[model samples]
Target chain A: MDEQETRKAVHDRIDQLDVPQDLVAAAIETGIDQASGKQVKPRRRRHLGRWILTAAAAVLLGVGGLAAVNPSVSRALSNVAWLTNFYLHHDDHFNSFHVNGIAKSMDQKVTSNGVTVHLVEAYYNGRTIGYTGEVTGLTKAIDPEQDWVPLDLDDTPAKNLTSSTSNFEPTKSGFRFHATFLVDKGEVPESVLLPIRISNVNGVVGRWNFNINLTQSQQKHAIQQKPYDLDLPGGEIIPVSMTTFASGAEFTFRTTTDGRYGFIGISAIKTAEEDQLIDGTDGYYASLGITHLPLKEPLVQGKTYHVVYQYQMKTDGSPEADIVGADIERDIVLWPAEQ
Target chain B: MELTLKEITWAQQAVAGDREALGQLLKSRGDYLYRTAYLYVGNQADALDVIQEATTQAVKTVAQLRDPNQFFTWFTRILIRQAQVLYRRRQKETTMAVPPEQVAPMIDATAHLDLLAALQVLGADYRQALQLFYYQDMSISEISQLLDVPEGTVKTRLRRGRSALHDQLGGNYYG
Candidate 1:
């Protein structure tokens, strides 16, 4: 075939590919459900403590001395826990620990530029730290397009800092703002004094300096680490270490120097469920930290686990290696019966 | 496809947390997304799965989008990424037990089988470049933006992809 005929042939083939209308409709329906938050399953029962915290705060504020004397209210207030439920529900890394009850309270507040910013709650697991709070005092809605960096606690921005903001339900004083920030796995400090400066908030800037005590959560658990050698399809052996935590397992390996051989991902199974694939985290290239392979349920001390590591080989000029396929390199059994 | 003003408005509303607007925007681009996904996975069922996943991801992360007018480019990027991921996962699952020749016979009959087979021999980057060029008729600049690569890289891929395709199909050069 000539140039014109080749173009026609390729175009004809691509055009002939068909998409079913029913599939399109179903996909749109599913997208709408997910977008509207209908598909998000209700979080674990641990979140009930958060609801109790909210209720306790309201009663303490409303009834004053009378509510303080109530046994249940007093007990809840003493717990004064920071709920990691929001992060636990959304992030795989944060979900590894079975955290219940709040940490120590750092309910600090400041007023400047006619706006009040409150640091409502803070939680520090062994790995991740997060804080949630609110900002009030605005005549009109702030620009939705602008992403205001509210605070910079550390000398540098945390490697995986994530922040989210939502408008509070409208009240007579106007709509307040609720915001939260989660700093991913980083070096933990005893205490951090976060200096907050929010600019362009209804034409006025808000500033606050609050000290947060990174009190370790009672729910933190120690991870058991074991080292092993994983053999790839091409007979190349790579050293890898595995760590098992309450929430999931982490595999750490070194990346290849030639950029040809690399760890792709892993699949794992407990006795109760079928094999489930876990995608490698965005942090995979950071010395090959295979973070967050969540178990079907939280890890039990004696339950056996089976896992297989997958790796890819991409040697130049090797057609066999050029095939885009990840092969299972090694199978591992965790918590052997003798152990 | 160039987005109309109404589609752009829908995208803006979708980014502003309007579920109905998201549905409308996704429905408008569903066919194109599915077709593009099909080019990557080479099967109708897997392509549909990729489209659904891409739609869900786009809706969840819509707030991060900066420009409403660039919705197609942003969504296409998400769709292609999802397709690549699913394709990789599928390859891993069947690579040992089943080879490409056995799977080719099961592909949907609507597509030209010979061309599809030839396309499979090209590297993923080359196949994607050729598909976007000839199938979607996207400009090299547009493809570069969609792929998040430099324009020069896109041009090189197109040149190399055409040459590879010509070689695979016995010097059937096009343009």
Candidate 2:
């Protein structure tokens, strides 16, 4: 066989390998939804007014008085740890989760092939779940930056799963890893069996399945405001809603019908006094939470806040725009402080 | 699969943030991407993972792409990077946990195709260059652009890779 024949053989062999149609369809679907800012599944409608009222009443009864004296209750509600171990060592941030005495501690370990993973503690506050653990008996050092430890929810309805690992260090035996997993509101069950798999451990993939039982505590302090319809440059109107929790305020911008331009995220947030530039650290954007702004001041109900956002063409193929000058401002009214 | 003019238009629309166009673009390139991934990872499941990850990365970073006409090249580069990452990771695992003989066999080439077996024996760089050259039918310049190397480097690799294949399977193997 000559080069031509060798080439033909190679092509024929590659063509013979079966590519699963289901996988292709799923991949295409996920790509479209992510690129379009569409939700994986349509969110079930909840009675926003009723739920907010109930959450507010619970907050008032639980920590309304403590909030006045220390302001820690309100602060804690605003300082949400979006990424695992993000604020773990930051005493001010990590202490807030413990202050409410809502966080649960567990000792679960899974050992396989000379590797052992110990899950120490976890905290779930309706929206995000954070857990910390240590691994031992691994010959190779685990670098979170290079390694992908994906949290797989078995027999659960979790969606939009985002995770972050921090404070990865080598121990005498192995390494200690802290990770946070974020799920959409009302996704995880009371008890979930989460299989955290380190897809690449120096190339040896391993999984540790932990049965986590969560105790639901009403968010100690939460304020919900009416959704605001904001106009864009292209004559498109997007509905923006703000919900304040103990960890932070979650701002959601609805996707527009025209796919040409979509809400990327807030560039700057203007409170009466100052303009805060949204560095990526401040928040993340998806269709859900356009930004989860950690509040400097407890959001007073009925008080209006101004938000400045930068929009971009949805796909990379779109022509470049002056995003710096393309700031769209909208005044958002907070729901009444008291029902 | 060869990209049609309509698909190129979709690629442009996709880069412009049109989700439907992006979907069409992904669908058109799905088989090609899968085959490329399979060449690197040598398995169905891992190849699928590579494609999924590459798609996600492409979607997230599509805005950074400058030329819409270069969408396939841009996306293919992303796919190759993903495959490389997975390949490196799997290599580490196999080296550490599994014995050489115990490692799972590569997908069986048809009987009498000793060249396929010989291809596996070649270094990753050589195999990759040869795979793109013969299997994907890519030009040296295209391979160089995708690999982010000079055209001369791609040519050298192609020459050396073919020579290695010939040496392994005997000179008449190619004929």
Candidate 3:
């Protein structure tokens, strides 16, 4: 083939590969949001504690927080207090893995300038890294008016790491904290030394560094199947794949055609008897794009469940250009009978 | 594809802070950007990611575009950089089990498939030069400005890249 033939061949191959119209619309909307300075920021839940600190906070605070609290009960509770505290106030997902003994117990602690930060326990499932710990003996008083940076983690291992922290429930001395980090790209190593540096506690600059070892659990239970194609309006087909992990269910949508932008959200997951699998008390999302829905418990085998989801499509960049929105329900059986 | 007159007008309007025009312009050029990104990243998911991020970056920094007509060049430059970052990051990853796609015979001896496979094995710098010169129909001067490399370097890379591809494909020669 000559130069002209080569160019034609290159163009022909590239022409066969097309990016879905829905994704293009999403990208354009993201761009417009940036240009208009209307990019939505992720909300951080902090200082809005509805539940008061009970025996759990005193366990971390030691003798300083609650005077009437028993020292014997505090020492007894300190060992497993962070675990129960994390489940009660923070995430229900951790309870699923912790109950299965899929977590590593850690008692690593660091002290700096009359303050102490403990790394209690860590849980990893090859997708997310979670920690439940506490900070005690903080000299600065808790102020609702001022934003506090109780911890600063050096997330060098995964540069695109996205993290979320639970509310700092202030104790008499300090507060008990929980954090979860997610690396979106490739799978992290089986064993990793996560370097965490705590500084600017209550706006005071002090470096308290610790290298916490996190290991991916070998006992994780997960199931995934071949892609299931969902047909939409205007001859568009989206291949949706489902993966159920011990902690949650992840739904990944594979684009198949070109037409318009689309948004999908999972409203609820319910069994055949209408038993809800997600905790209603906790905040569940009507997610955008691809997302993982954390369940209260894993779905049982040979059981039928209804996944109620909402979808909307947009043909243009304008907000008013949305073409259709509807709720659809899909029935799926885990480990279905052999065909 | 070369920038059209209407696209140029949109770029000028986008620089002047008209977000709607910017959105329209991005929508129009989305396919081109997506294809270019796929060439660099070698996957659909990462290509989409690169396009989305590059779009956001472009929209946020459109005001810095002194020459509105150079919007494609500027935007393509941003996209290539982002694609490279993701590509490099993915390269560092190690999987325990061999992926099925890697083991399978991915390409036949067809001209397009052979060229694609040859391009995939080429060095990053060579691939970029060839991609711009052939796929995007860009001149050496344009590529030099976009890559911030001297014209001589761009020409040499195109020569070396074409030679490498020719040797791999056995007969095909890039212009």
Instruction: Compare the candidates by lDDT and give the number of the best one.
Output: 3
lDDT of 2 by residue, B1-175 (tens): 3567998789778788776777778877678788888778755556666877787788788878888887887887888899899878766655345321111222222344355457656777988898888877788888887898999999888889878987986775444
Candidate 3 CAPRI assessment class: incorrect
Q: Which numbered prediction scores highest in TM-score against the true structure? A: 3
Fraction of native Cα contacts kept in each candidate? 0.36, 0.34, 0.38
Model 3, TM vs. native? 0.42
Each prediction's DockQ against the real complex: 0.14, 0.15, 0.16
Question: Interface-residue RMSD per candidate?
Answer: 21.0, 9.3, 14.6
Would you list the rank order by lDDT, best first? 3, 2, 1
Candidate 1 residue-wise lDDT, B1-175, digit = tens:
6789899899899889887888888778777777788779865556756777788888789999999888887888888899899878765544233323223111112435566677777778998988887777788888888888999999899899888877877765554
Stronger candidate by TM-score (1 vs 3): 3
State candidate 3's DockQ: 0.16
Please report how far candidate 1 places residue A194 from its true position, in Å: 58
Give residue A298's lDDT in candidate 2 (0 to 100): 39
For residue A61, give model 3's deviation from the true position in Å: 38
Q: Which ten residues in a row have the lowest lDDT in candidate 3 chain A?
A: A58-67
DockQ computed for model 2 against the true two-chain complex using alpha carbons: 0.15
Model 3 residue runs over 4 Å out of place are A1-103, A125-128, A140-160, A183-193, A218-231, A234-257, A277-304, A315-320, A330-339, B1-175
